[model samples]
Target: MRLTRTILAFALLAAVAPIALAQSQVEITSDVFVMNEAARQAEFEGNVMVVHPNVTVWAPKVVATYGEGGTTDIRTFEASGGNVRLKTADQDATGERAVFTPGDQLLRLTGNVKVTNASGTVDASELVVNLETNVSTFTSTGGGRVTGIFTSQ
Candidate 1:
């Protein structure tokens, strides 16, 4: 069966308005950055790393899609391959691929997703996180349940 997923752009814009307004200048570096003005898309390949105020993303490739034809108007991001890692504050997470939709204030991590912090680690096949609400949901791709291990001092 073919399933269609739809997300409203404006809704995403509204959901992420707070983050957009409070964001600081973003710095990105990679072996290659491919920008397409006409398509309003940018792709960073080969050890792509993005540094923002409180967030850092590292991946083999990262893609940004924009609504307007400018880099400042990024709507969403996809970090893929090379065990994508995302770090913010005291949290660190790794996955095969991660999709962050600022507009929706949502981050989706897939393929052996693992999240860790000072406490412990949570592992699952898929993880969805809401940046605004600070909530997360994890689902296993197979019949197995999500797992977590916490250590206390």
Candidate 2:
């Protein structure tokens, strides 16, 4: 009888563990919003704000997609219309438009992108960022400028 009780307890704990681990919470705010229930996606318009974990992003409009099959693909995160603001522990970026591929941890910003960190600030017409590697490439189109300001702190 004691052995059977112990086995049942372990089985119950095992079943609940996965449930707790797989759960996620997302919060979004905007002037107007629409959600697709079947796809588990959302679109926000007019001063959109998205917060997940330690990251916060703000833009004029944003579309968010989630992955299927218990993965963190994120599918696509696109921000347009106005400047995008992304704040994380390591860095911060601002641009006119931004697209992020969460699975790859890649962020592409265009139309006057500017990135600032403890090191300095880089401004360009286009910026591609690899979040995982902390590397960024800046480029210009039609006579753009990149200005860096380094401070010793």
Candidate 3:
């Protein structure tokens, strides 16, 4: 149970950490909002969006779990089943699925992952962003090469 809670904390924090480290209120909206208090989970379907001061996430579906019986404290979230987008003021990432865990300090993006910023764009089959160290690693193993277009320093 403690591990689950820790994972939840990591996962949800990973999603927003790229934007900033400070804690802020996050707002999520969708066509359907279903909460299961018994399970401490929520399901948002159809045009699901998680919005913050400097960051925004959009997907067709998002599954979130809360911690410590707190409805507002989302410990973890997974977005899937479409072009899942994580956008900040300058950077943008899109993938088929996105999973974040801040406690573990890992952010995973898979399936046609593309990350773009003013500097350039990177394409990979999978992307792992280390939230703790602010490092990113991209890989592709399915005969698809990791491609990137880099601009000036």
Candidate 4:
């Protein structure tokens, strides 16, 4: 079932409004959309898909929490499901859950996370990326080990 895009568009606007990029239009769709203005939160479920100029995400559910300062400021953007997949110009990743904290410029993916790029592929129980420092740390759980394969340019 298709729902109206107007509400979703407005909700997403608040999420991307802070971006100064030239083309920052974001298109999001889902079978369900729940918005709480007072709480400054929006939830999308069932075939949730978000498309931005720099990245695209597909998941069964997504929750966006905005900051108190204003709707334009997003605090946390989270995607969770059996299989959540995200793609960008350079990489593709899949995990059970992905959470991004805009305030700290940090992204965390957990639960059998696997990331692949032109350079290589990495598998771990969790992956944390600090966008501010441009660092990615991957680790495993339950005595498991993180593994990856790389290719020389």
Estimate the TM-score of every prediction. 0.81, 0.69, 0.80, 0.86
Q: By TM-score, who's the top model here?
A: 4
Select the stronger candidate by TM-score from 1 and 2.
Answer: 1
Please write out the lDDT profile of model 4 over residues 54-122, one tens digit for every residue. 788899998888877655667888899878998989999999999988778788999999999999999
Note the clash tally of each candidate: 1, 0, 7, 0
Winner on lDDT between 1 and 2 is 1
Instruction: At residue 3, give the lDDT of candidate 4.
Output: 52
lDDT of model 1, residue 129: 82
> Which wins on lDDT, candidate 1 or candidate 4?
4
Identify the superior model by TM-score, candidate 3 or candidate 4. Answer: 4
Judging by TM-score, tell me the better candidate of 1 and 3. 1
Residue-level lDDT tens digits of model 2 in 1-153 = 667544533332222212112324546678986655466455679988766655678889987665563223346778888678878787898888888775677778898777888988888889887877979788988865677788888
Write down the lDDT of every candidate, Cα atoms only. 0.75, 0.68, 0.77, 0.81
lDDT of 3 by residue, 55-128 (tens): 78999998876678464465666889868999989899999998876457677889999999999999999999
Best-to-worst order by lDDT is: 4, 3, 1, 2
Q: Whole-model lDDT for model 4 versus the true structure?
A: 0.81
Q: Highest lDDT, which number?
A: 4
User: Which ranges of candidate 4 are over 4 A from the true structure?
Assistant: 1-11, 17-23
In terms of lDDT, the poorest run of 10 residues in model 3 is: 12-21
Model 1 Cα shift for residue 42 (angstroms):
0.8
Q: Is candidate 1 or candidate 3 better by lDDT?
A: 3
